[model samples]
Target: MTGLSPDARAWLEQHGFIPTDDAVWLEALTHGSFNGSGPADAADYQRLEFLGDRVLGLSVAAWLFRAGDAPEGKLSQRLNALVSGTTCARIARSIGLPEHIRLGKQARDDGGADSDKILGDVMEALIGACFIEHGFDTAQGLIYRLWAKELEGDVGKAKHPKSALQEWAAGNRRAPPVYTVTDRSGPDHAARFTVEVSVRNVGNAEATASSKGEAERLAAKAFLERFG
Candidate 1:
């Protein structure tokens, strides 16, 4: 109701995602924090998230199985990387999923609508909703369309900065880089972190990010790029 339009529906359908139940679609877009009064009042996306996570895992696993020539370990690693929170968030953003998310006033006011975590969860929920409305084939088709770029091109290639850093460190025989939070600032609700990454023998590099985890990842990536 809030974000759905004929154009949006047509776009999604053309991309292989068909939602038979509009209410389910809306629920998939709703955030849990917005459902203060419970499911009867406002159905949230948590259940759909759970279902979608499993569906995505299964779909990716099936894809790897059919792709061929990949070892179990390699396939597992690729699956993990592809399904990571960052990757999912990126996919959500690419589809403009955040624009369709249904957040409560508080969440909208606090910028929760644009949050990667929320967007990622909602993306999963959308997948789950599609799966329920149609089936695995439909859901997988949609996922493939969304992820074709990442999956079709060098499926096992390590592209992320963090992964690149680890590979470089291991190759150079230096103790793996170490990341530490050097500083934290901002309000309690929206804190930012500065991270410093020190390679065993190389100099330290620093980066700032909205979250400590992200900052550490960025710092490690920067250190690897500069010194690895």
Candidate 2:
């Protein structure tokens, strides 16, 4: 079976993704929308996404567990942060994966290649493909190589902005913070959301991000910076 398209192979090869099973790797990069689909088929990356999600979680979890003698809660936090779709998408971008996704004309036109969901899922699918064609050790090695920076960064010590905001609200004897999505715009794949966060009489602040959750987090962070 023919492997990755020439350009895709070159791009992936640049990122150390040489493939033994070209067909599966090709399928791994094929989006559900590749053929203007209703749902993903075996040819698409959905199933691979599922498998890869699990693989990524396991790899990250194991790595964290081994790297730290931190408590379970701390290990869990690192695992969650490292395996998040946002993190996956960030890693995809760092590796220039957006252009490598095989998409249908409509999806491509709609900016699906840059969508967080698409990029994250494709990253996971790539992991799944590597794991299936090679083995767990190989997949784990790839993950370690890709996630080295995040694993070494200050992610563990940095409290999530939203959680910190909630704690601040309670500590200040204010009502729980409220987040309202003020606006949503752009295509389905790459939409943006603007959120406003308020803490009763304390103060309010607003921010925007690619996803609603991220928007809310930014809004909370803004509120904290402005009022807390």
lDDT values for all models: 0.77, 0.85
lDDT of 2 by residue, 1-228 (tens): 345667887877777666877878888898866756423443888888999999999998888878869898788777878887789999999999988888888888888888888898899999999899888888998999999999998755578889899999888899999999999998776788999998888879999877898889889888888898
Per-residue lDDT over 54-92 for candidate 1, one digit per residue giving the tens place of the 0 to 100 score: 898899889888988888878887897677666788888
Highest lDDT, which number? 2
User: How close to the true structure is residue 107 of candidate 2, measured as C-alpha lDDT?
Assistant: 82
Q: After superposition, how far is residue 54 of candidate 2 from its true place, in Å?
A: 0.8
Model 1 alpha-carbon miss at residue 163, Å: 5.0
Candidate 2 accuracy as lDDT: 0.85
